[model samples]
Target: TVDKYGDNSIKLGITNMLIGEYLHTIDNKKRLAVPAKLRDKIGKKAVITRGLDNCLFLYPLKEWEALAEKLSKLPVGQGDTRSFIRLMLAGASEVEMDSLGRILIPDYLKNYAELKKDIVIAGLYNRLEIWDKEKWSLYKENAGRNSEEIAEKLGELGVY
Candidate 1:
């Protein structure tokens, strides 16, 4: 299991964790059954928030706390960072899986991410990202188009 406690101490903990992609439907009432493999690492409780790719991000409690700290550091008077913090925080929700590993996503968040029935859940290092299927497909296409250019830019930043 990933070290939940260690995740608490650092604002961002790193873990390879279980990585896969799965598609499931959000029920009429906005309930989703988390994949079993992810459940084992995150346990029953999780914090969900907005992510950069117009998708939902799920983090363990400790990981969420770490993120909260970083967001808190953003100046309220600033433009971009403040807006980011507000949007991300406003979309955040805390949820726990039932015995069957089902989580009830609030309607507001569902609407924010334009999520309907089908959702794609993917493991991304320390956290998980959920996307509406069609939206995710579009995102992948966009990313693919920019992949080479983006890599070149990263290399210029000494990221290579």
Candidate 2:
């Protein structure tokens, strides 16, 4: 249920807390420099996991703890909740940024998200999502494709 908030939360996190975008290059080895703005808030130690979208998820330890705390109270009988918990917790990896503020993204995750030479790091509330640049472009274009339908739906909810 923790992840069940409307997609608006996703947009709000990215635009409000994240506030800006950092387009950076990923090395051949999948190493990336954490944006200075984000690094200042996240510190050297962080956690990485599978994101809801097709992107690698990054979180500060404190943020992960908050999420974990919220998830702990969910009913265990719900299959979807269990699956989300398993995927999020099992995929999480604790990592430390190197002296140069770089973190090594796991190969499996990189391959899962198709992250390679170029990447985009954006803030999303308590966490961050890393996206392959080209994939991000395509995703952005498609995300806007149904804007009118989305607006109409939001209007029904008194959000527009």
Candidate 3:
């Protein structure tokens, strides 16, 4: 479905992917309203976790299960790998979306992301990244300025 933002999440028969940036707010109780366009794809149940770059990652149940499976197979002998696994798995919380399409953000995660009243829910394929509005704005500005350099690196990796 295309939202007012004109972003499309489904294409070519693929399922469970998302795309868009939605401006929303968390209430005094820390309940976040998931965009209707995204809630269906995200499913009634989701996983919320600490993500990199000080943002929270919200994943659909199926995707999170798949990711957990893959993460379980990584080399446990590597110290960094073990640490990374702990950071992800140990920090994850299974959340159920309410009838109003809301999910409660745990205090730890809210504090971790430094979330204020305003937020930007960015729909990244297979997950949503919740960022504080100001941080998202600054990060977008910096990333926009570096897009050419970033694309060059992706090109080197044969991904651009």
User: What does candidate 3's lDDT look like per residue over 4-78, in tens digits?
Assistant: 323344544456568899999999999999998888788778899999889999998777989999999999999
- With a 3 Å backbone cut-off (N, CA, C), the pairs that clash in candidate 3 are none
Query: TM-score: which is higher, 1 or 2?
Result: 1
TM-score of each: 0.84, 0.80, 0.89
- What order do candidates take by TM-score, descending? 3, 1, 2
Clashes per candidate (backbone, < 3 Å): 0, 0, 0
Model 2: per-residue Cα lDDT over 1-160, one tens digit each: 1232111222233433544567999887778999876675666788888887788888877678888888888887999999998878888888888888999988878887888788988776667889999988888788799889989999999999
The positional error of residue 6 in candidate 2, measured at the CA in angstroms, is 31
TM-score of 3: 0.89
> Candidate 2: where are CA atoms >4 Å away?
1-16, 151-160
lDDT of 1 by residue, 58-77 (tens): 88777688888999987788
Worst 10 residues of 3 by lDDT: 3-12
Best of the candidates, TM-score: 3
For model 1, name the residue pairs that clash.
none
Lowest lDDT 10-residue stretch of candidate 2: 1-10
Which should have the higher lDDT, number 1 or number 2? 1
Compared with the true structure, the alpha-carbon lDDT of candidate 3 equals: 0.89
